[model samples]
Target: MAISNKVYAMPPVVDANSRLLFLGSMPGTASLAASRYYGHARNHFWPILYRLHGAGVPDASYEDRLRFALAHGCALWDTIASCERKGSLDADIREAVPTDIPGLLRAYPGIEVIVCNGGKSYETLDRHHGMHPEVLRRAVLKVPSSSPIPTRQHKGLEEKAAAWLAALSPFVKPRGDAQGG
Candidate 1:
């Protein structure tokens, strides 16, 4: 059977009030199949998020997880709008069309911080989204990938989560009244 290569069919999980934006390169095979970001069971995205913000469970429902991130002033999207790949690996990607990041920033002016989940997204943004003046103005944090696929550097979960937490610190809204009587 011939392999289906086109990827990136899901809409971004973003809202008008989002102050922080998390960008992945593109949805992986698991994410596309499940129609959810970071759907691969072994991916550390959820666990890192859960560790950073104690309010949500890593195993929470998809909608609930989206709600949790949105409620906390964050948004999620991919750098590549579409790409052709034989598998889930970023190295296999080809003909990647980047998303309208500048448009998104314009639509949501409140977005003050942008964080890239991995190197590909960061590189994509630099190559494709860097032309816009507004995009160039904002700093993009290129954190370690949370995917289960090991990197040559091999940063531990705690290290990656720490870096993510540091990058997200400025935008994270204070958890209010959690200890209420």
Candidate 2:
């Protein structure tokens, strides 16, 4: 038996030390129900994260993953603050309330890059939010959708995705999660 969360996508947690930030559009049906990020069965987020670190995500708790991300100077967040989804399809999002990133960036001055978790998140940021050729100077790499919704490989896109994660790997160190506090 699984519970369901109906409000919105859970915000990715990070501490002051996070150096990289990952942004998705919103929580999918699976994620929302689990009250966790990237809960979809087919979603490759876990695998990709594990691959990046050359190990598993440490534990089942999202907090643990956040700790891993923080230790590696990485942060996780969604592109949309709120949205109405008939189910989990990003294409089904009706009215999206984008998150205010500049504010978060200011609070945590260490973040160097913002990686969009999927193509939808990427398009929303690039198309709707006015992050264009100039805004993309920060390097908004459109990575593969980790969603298990469709397993069809996105061709050479995986290489770019792996590279993006690799760029942040040097910072990951053996550190326990801060959630205990």
Candidate 3:
């Protein structure tokens, strides 16, 4: 496939109450086409999140899902602000421009943890903004990609959920508990 022209990431889904920031590499082809994060049908992102938080169904409307995430103090964004790539694979990204993570952190001081959704997101954060004082102060968790593509270690949704839950449970409260009684 020919490399496409520069593709930009969608604006972050964040707010003052956001306590956990989830960073993906960039929107995949399906996600970009649909203008929704983790839009692909096979991706485990939504399912994992719903399973972990147990509030909304994974099949809920896009807006509902976004609200669910935000209600749980979770924010979502991509590490790469813009890049050229032939397809959805992270390896194909070129001329990558990183998102202003430090700026986001500064704006949302409530965010206590940064969760890299995959290796590319983690690598991008580490390579581009790791040294920033804002980034250095927060906890960063590198979790397995929630993609449907199987790996030797994380071979299915259950495995991915286990890993994600383990990494995020301390910070992500269920919807009922998120608002704080």
What TM value does model 1 have?
Answer: 0.88
Clashing residue pair totals per candidate (backbone < 3 A): 0, 6, 0
Name model 1 segments beyond 4 Å from true: 1-4, 173-181
**Is 1 or 2 the stronger prediction by lDDT?**
1
lDDT by candidate, in order shown: 0.81, 0.66, 0.91
Clashes in candidate 2: how many?
6
Give one digit per residue, the lDDT tens place, for model 1 in 1-181: 9777888747778888787788999888989999998899888888887666655556568888888788766889999999899879889999999899999898888888888999998999999877787687777788888888766775567777777887776555436534441
Please give the lDDT score at residue 5 for candidate 2.
30
Per-prediction CA RMSD (Å): 3.0, 6.8, 2.2
Quick one: best lDDT, which candidate?
Answer: 3
Output the number of the TM-score-best candidate.
Answer: 3
Writing each residue's lDDT as its tens digit, candidate 2 over 19-114 gives: 667888888777878887776666677667766655653457766765666666667788788876677788788778777766676677676667
TM-score leaderboard ranking: 3, 1, 2
What is candidate 3's lDDT per residue for 27-131, written digit by digit as tens? 999999999999999999999989778654585689988988887788999999999988888989999999999999999999999999999999999999999
TM-score versus the correct structure, for each prediction: 0.88, 0.74, 0.93
